[model samples]
Target: MTLPAPARFGIMTAPSQVDYADLLRVWREADTVPGIEHAWLFDHLLPIYGDPRGVTYEGWTLLAALAAHTRRLRLGVMVTSNRFRPPAVLAKIAATVDVVSGGRLDFGIGAGSRPDVPMARREYEAHGLPYHDGAHAVSALAEACAVIRRLWTEPEPFDFTGEHIRLAGAFGNPKPVQRPHPPVLVGGRASATLRVAAEHADVWNYPGDDVADAVRRGALLDRHCADLGRDPASITRSLVLPVSYDDPAPVRETIRRATAAGFRHLVLMLPAPYPEGVARWLADEIIGERPV
Candidate 1:
């Protein structure tokens, strides 16, 4: 198969209550970055990194604001966990963001696991929501994907019956500008996750540092696609890389290795204190060169 060039590159901003200006600045700089195609933010009510009390911005609101300010880069949440919101509501939000961005939206979803992030347990009890273990969360994610897709495509007031979600005559209005719907990016390394990606998602983003591992995962996704009687080429495989470097060499090497390993997209995770540095690093490297 001929490998296509990456269509999106991004970093997730850990959500907080007060980082809107900084997040906007990051989006502006990334929009101008040479090789970057998108800017992503994490959807959470609290910080996933740094001090638990540090400033953070809401993800969807930040994406909406970034859409208005930056004319170029695509925008999305890294992966909206299935536990946090109802599938119908999530679908509507994704459509809204896509409209706001004029169709530059990538919907990345997954069974989110942030055990050390403090906010998980808090919300579980406070809201009396079901606490999902990894397996259960993955199940919920699969069901949610079907629900969201149905809500996007099925004509006016469709009914959905699923393991986790059941609905009758739910609204899926305005329809996403991206044909069919906005691209869905699913993240996980497990078999179930790959199954979900093969069956539903447009992209598969895996978070890891191993190139061979990414290749192996990509192959697994391909095999899963074959089993499902779907074309493996239809799903894009990508990586979420950490950019903790002041020097550009490491980041460049990382993207190069990942691309060579068959990852079409590199989701670069920008450093928190200086997010614009991510744009500068991308400009200095990896822009016009074809992968070797």
Candidate 2:
């Protein structure tokens, strides 16, 4: 395949690791770039890699602030943990933020997963949240998606009953500006996750460092869509990967291979303490070359 035209690019940053001042500066600078379509924040209570107790701003709080600060760029958490809040609450927050941003929100969510670290487990226990794993976690996430969709589209209050969530006469007011709801980007590569994506997501995102993985996952998603009697073309494919600014060759190659693999949306995960002018340079080099 020759890949689709006009690939969309986005930036993902860790708000907890980056200073608020620098985060604001980067958002402002990125807004001026023409080809950057969305700005994403990771959903983590603490740093995932190093210094587990590091300072980190809440994802929703930062998103709300960013909504007020930027005018053109769309904003969202790369993938909010489903366990962080109740589905109804998450729906309301997303609705309000979409309104605040004048309809620029892409709601990405996933089954919460934890790294093999003691602190990661402790954080979950400290917050009084169950840390589900394997199929159970994915099933819970599916139920969450169902609740969120109902809250977004259902006009009359109705009871929602699920294995993991239950609501009676629930209603979500001031629905998001986007019809039906904001674009839901489901993230994960597991079979259950792909099945959920096929059934519910407008976009499916996978995190990996290789294009081959994207290609394999894309095929798997197609199979899932087929099983559900859904059109595979209805779902947009997206890839999330880390890119270094010092080496433009590798970044370019990744983009090229990803495009070939049918990924139209490429979210570049920028390292903490982002290098100055790197975002602008990327916009100029990659996005500027693509036809509008």
Candidate 3:
């Protein structure tokens, strides 16, 4: 059976404040927007790449709250770091979130970077101390995926015996509404990251300053999928494009270029204190056509 193109279009909710009610309102509005297939938020404790003082919210708690407020709109973290949470716990949490959202949850995982260093360095620091070895991150990620899968599909309690996480008779119930599992989306530019996605992800999210880079990275993902004997068609490609909107011409050009580059789902990352004005602008000018 031919799969329809993955749901296209989303909005990223990354704010400088930790207000659940305010964010929920924005997500509700987004759910009604025509052509928008999903909504996403970032996962981080402190600002990973910006001023340390920037306001950051807990990704899972906020997502759980979002699930309660919106009836539609697929929701998930843009990409969560592997080192932040333990694998077994993350698995159960994701399953619970999926259940809460009535199966609208998608999981995006990655090896994230710190403010001052490239993530490839593998030395992730928080509060001024080293946290994990670089090479070990991938192992943790794989183990996490394994535990989540077992939690969702395996009958009765199951055990996840891995180097980083160990589970004995862990039980998870009320399986996600999505059969088997919710879509797992992975983000990164590394070959190993791409390989991991090829093996496990239901969607591949590409981030870039421009559409061209996103397409380039997307093509790389396709190649990786081909190598792994997975159908490229099975993996949905999404892109996040930053917009300033000061110049209509440049922004339009960027959108045109991005669509041409095969970004089926494109989300714009807006700044904090997200108001109706930005949503209106994106709906009227960018998303095009009125909301549902």
Candidate 4:
């Protein structure tokens, strides 16, 4: 009935190959469950799984709709691809979501997916979105974090000149409801991305299933933090684990392992077609039952 100290839980439902009605139902149900403190969606323009032409909702747009529909669960794109939109434009989009969600936005971002991942690459090519190399992507992502934060917090319009980003008189009107901006979550395990997280992220998210690898990456982040004179503990370590409907044992064990491993922010990713009362099941089964 009690969660381990400092552990926070949430859910992620990717918008690809999933119907809006189903996604809405899950979010609405999750909003009432106290065990789940936050929710997330991934960003991708095209279907990366299932049918190549399956319907895919834009993360921000779908997120805004979910924000309006849910009264509580903190929400955001798991990691908005930095290459998808200009930094200033993404800032405005995020600010609007924060306002809509009444300040429950956790701004998660990362460098775009690598060109080697065909699913990711095809989407870029299909949409005419350029896929940059790792170095360029990481550098641009760093500049993006800086520029976006300034847009959210700066009082007046200002010009910016960075190696990867430049803006003239860029300003955000009707600032986000969260003062000094929403919590910034940078997601990735790459060393360069970790360096960016050390400098800018309030929370750093590690993708995939390998817990030990994530811990190793976290150590790398700690080193990066040291180099920047930032306390390693200042950044929350987050990781995602997949949920299984047929067997809750593996998921529960993963949760236990992850929490014990010092991953305080745990996001349980639910595979769809989400079963009936899935959120309630998650609370009762996957996560320990709520306190009596």
Deviation of model 2 at 132, angstroms: 2.0
Candidate 3 residue spans exceeding 4 A from truth: 1-7, 17-21, 49-51, 114-130, 289-292
For model 2, the run of ten residues with the poorest summed lDDT: 113-122
Q: Taking the tens digit of each residue's C-alpha lDDT, what string does model 3 give over 1-292?
A: 8534433667887743546667877888877776566888887666644565656777888888888788888888888877777666777788888888888898888766533454323323443434565467666676777677777777798766778888898877767778888888887766677777788888778755466667677777889888888888787777776766664455556666666655566677766666565666777777674211
Per-model TM-score on C-alpha atoms: 0.89, 0.95, 0.86, 0.97
Report the Cα lDDT for candidate 4.
0.92
Deviation in Å, model 4, residue 168 alpha carbon:
0.6
How many steric overlaps does candidate 2 have?
0
User: What TM-score, to 2 decimals, does candidate 2 have?
Assistant: 0.95
Output the lDDT of residue 226, model 4: 95
Point out the worst 10-residue segment of candidate 3 by lDDT: 119-128
**Candidate 1, 1-292: lDDT as tens digits:** 8646654566655556445777777778877775677778776655555565666565777778788898888778887877888889989988888888889998989887645546556656555667767777888898899888878887778777888889988988878888888889998888888888899888898866678787888888999999999999888787877765556667678777777676777777766566446576665664445544
Per-model RMSD to reference: 2.5, 1.9, 3.6, 2.4
Instruction: State in Å the error of residue 209, model 1.
Output: 2.6
Best by TM-score: 4
